[model samples]
Target: MTKDLLGRHRAVLPDWLALYYDEPLEITHGEGRHVWDADGNRYLDFFGGILTTMTAHALPEVTKAVSEQAGRIIHSSTLYLNRPMVELAERIAQLSGIPDARVFFTTSGTEANDTALLLATTYRRSNTILAMRNSYHGRSFSAVGITGNRGWSPTSLSPLQTLYVHGGVRTRGPYASLSDDEFIAACVEDLTDLLGHTRPPAALIAEPVQGVGGFTAPPDGLYAAFREVLHERGILWIADEVQTGWGRTGDHFWGWQAHGRSGPPDLLTFAKGIGNGMSIGGVVARAEIMNCLDANSISTFGGTQITMAAGLANLTYLLEHDLQGNARRVGGLLIERLRAVAAQVPAVREVRGRGLMIGIEVVRPGTDEADPQAASAVLEAAREGGLLIGKGGGHNTSALRIAPPLSLTVAEAEEGAAILERALRSIS
Candidate 1:
């Protein structure tokens, strides 16, 4: 069934648009943590549309909200007064942690980051920027220029001058052998020294956890230490929390909180999970930074009534049910179970993540080299076992990304982990 569709897909879609499995499964519908393929095969979902399905599939509250809003009205440009937009913005602003916070809605993370870059460069008066190696911001012309992942970056051309930094990946960088404290110190020194040689950068934009870079992250306090250095130089800090926000990491509300001893980042961009499958993304910054632009800016469908209705309902359900605590409790058990399973498999090099987000790095047996082929095999094996998952890594896409919806139960976690165990052992 999917083969016929696959032929049509290839005939029109761009080749760069990747798909999973030997033959991609067509997900017709889903409810809770399970989804069905075109052949009516049900499978436990772990990837959650690359972690975008923050709540659950076919969630009743979000469905009702969208239906109700759609029945009344949907599209209203930014020129009009939008109650849902204003309400969601107020809620996000209060939760942003930035003093005197302001919110600007965008349709995707790329646009949010682009708006942030615009704000930073205009306010700081420098086109230079600092980005982490193996990090991915987005696909826009401006966003791709700052991306350090070779596979994701298609062109060398960029409007801003971006310099890559170390410390986002903890296990493979030059500072891999250093202790957490030493690693932080070394990265700080590098940033300080780098600044001495180049023009002052507008900001340092980074993902607290590199989602597309295989869920790798440095020591908890690494960014906090860097924050101090950037603060001293009057440079802004932007946290790309698209994958790490809304308590998906299990331990914190936002990934930046782990390294927030120095306080919150100057500007924060978020997407993916907040709207649960609805297209909603935005940037939160201080009033000074957000209001810096004198020109008019608006996203046609960014803060539309229907999407904001979905966002309001989703966010309410998330908070009212204490989903963050559920993630912390459930994700803790999931990771430990996977770790035990990983120890029994030779192809499993490392299993690391916080909260509900997890990554299993597969490698050539007895070697540290990334094994993309083995990773692909496991992905296929998992699907064959009635399970669905994802793969990502800046290095040849060799890591299996396992991020279930935040609302996952203990039984579901165990079931997914067992399926993954068989998948991992198959490659052994």
Candidate 2:
């Protein structure tokens, strides 16, 4: 953990890696809810490696599994059957509660979404997809095509068909005045309008709780209604649980459960938290939908031995310790604290989200909308105070995203909140 080591590492990062507005930090090591920079400065991990690292960074169980599996076999092509991969897929299907579920593993969340889109659209042989505004599927061609935000555009290729609808979440301004009834009505109306006079879509992609686009939670019953609409249209519903799954939401093991249904989505994509820090992603498909997929469509790096082992270890840790329950309790506490903070702080507009996927929207004078600069300042101040957070919303910025690892403790949550309060105080 020295400047020399960072210099060597930085040299390896190619210029082709787009500078996404900000520079990357030189982090060296991490354990549980804390990380160390190259200069050996400890920082609280409120961002959880940009919403990954489900069991906390450097968890012994995940590391041991990866190490042991790597020693045995790092990878084998999809041409061969690997025990760890098969077991992991079985576990995902069982936990997902999807009947006759099938899985397609990949290396990242984007890939999982991409696979979901391919399987879903191909199954129905329908090109049209209905997506919500402020939705983020991923950066890949298919994913970006359905993404609602314009900032991520510069589309490499156009989707065969796509339509955008405004869901329960709003990206334009604050929600202090919106009522529950109004929220549901807005979503329903938009969905109706999108479906009206349009060809029945192949699939409807949505996040049970929007993450990267903004920490916007959908209204109650919205999912139920949305699902009904898709069902009527003969379209599949794909839940992008990449940021919301693996017990991060607390109420259930997966994000789609928040919608309160015996059966959730026709297809569900998962990544980020499954393998702790390892590169792994997957999709759980309904039996009927999966049955339509061709057998030859397999991924090369999907479900590699190391990734599968890590996923298994991570899942074991989460279930054995009931980390989802911790997320519900701790995340509820954090949201309440944030609401209190928002009341006192003028720049703080609204606090929203479920479990650990939380956001603190910064308000400006005479404006209920997002203030990206203020959010950035708060992120910097928090980092200076030994906490790390992320910034995201419609305009490539706005609210501070406070998704931490499930291992984050109550004491750490309190300390991080205090630091965030101080950061807001420093902003004005």
Candidate 3:
């Protein structure tokens, strides 16, 4: 049945849509932190469907909200004044640190980021934009224009003149040899030099922790320093918090807070994990920036009633349960466990990230060369051991991404770590 379904899926779906594993598994359903495959094999879920499952699978609260809202109304597009949408927006606005914030809903992270770029370019009156290297915003044409990762980006042509910046990845760049403070200073100097050479950019969009870039991140407060320089030039700062928002990082509610010295960014785009599997994405900006567009614009299904209900319920559960704190407590233990396991394996290059969004960078046994095959082997080994994880990196795609639900339990973390240890040992 699974093989037949895979065949049909390939026949219907685009070729570019990639599937994981040599024999791709079909997940049937899930509960808590575990999911069962089509063959009735249960596995602990670590990737959480690319971190879209913010809380947990089949969370009762979100399911109940969606069901209740569906009974009332499925969707009353933006043409109608949606009560649930307004309520969710109100809650998100207050939660968002931006003062006088206005929220604009979209259907996905790609749309949310496209909206950010539209607003930034319109408000700043410039087509030139700045983005970090090894960064990925989304798949839309406008979003792709700013993406710096060649693997994710399909084309070179773009509407915006994008300038790639340094500091998103700290370990393999020109400043990799420098100390943290010096690295940051060098990045700032590079940015300053770039600014002098190009037209004033509309905004500098970045992911606090580069999600697709192998969960890599510069030192904490790196953005704060950049913010000081950009502020001086009247450039807007856009934090692409699609993968790092909503307390997934443990220590910070928003990823930008790691560099909070300059206060909130001028714009913040978020998606994935907010709706707990429901399609919900949006941008939060100061009223001045959000309201700059002259023509009327509305997302027909952006804030549909059903999705908003899910968002509200998911948000409530996340806060009421303090899952962020859970992520911190459990994630810290998991990282340490994985690091200890990695230390014994020369193929395991690095263990990086915080909270639930940890990354394991695998390399060749004796050299610094990225070993994608090793990463793939570990992924397969872990899956065989009844664990599910994800893979990503800058260009090599050799980093193992482990982002379990924020509501993950300490016991679950340990169980997953033990399975991962055996998998890594298999490679070494």
Q: Clashing residue pairs in candidate 2, if any?
A: 347-363
Error of 1 at 381 (Å): 0.4
TM-score for candidate 1:
0.99
Q: Per-residue lDDT for 293-370 in model 2, tens only? A: 676666789999999999999999999998999999999999898888878888877788888889888878457766
315-383: candidate 3 lDDT, tens digit per residue: 999999999999889999999999999999999988999999999999998777899888999999999
Question: What is the Cα-based lDDT of residue 162 in candidate 2?
Answer: 81
Worst ten in a row by lDDT for model 1: 389-398
TM-scores for all candidates: the values are: 0.99, 0.93, 0.99
Q: Model 1: per-residue lDDT, tens digit, 243-305? A: 999999988999999999999999999999999999999999999999999898777989999
- Candidate 2 stretches with Cα past 4 Å from truth are 1-24, 168-178, 395-397
RMSD of each: 0.9, 2.5, 0.8
lDDT of model 2 at position 414: 95
- Candidate number of the best lDDT: 3
Question: Once superposed on the true structure, which residue ranges of model 1 sit more than 4 Å away at CA?
Answer: 395-397
Model 2 residue 365 lDDT score = 49
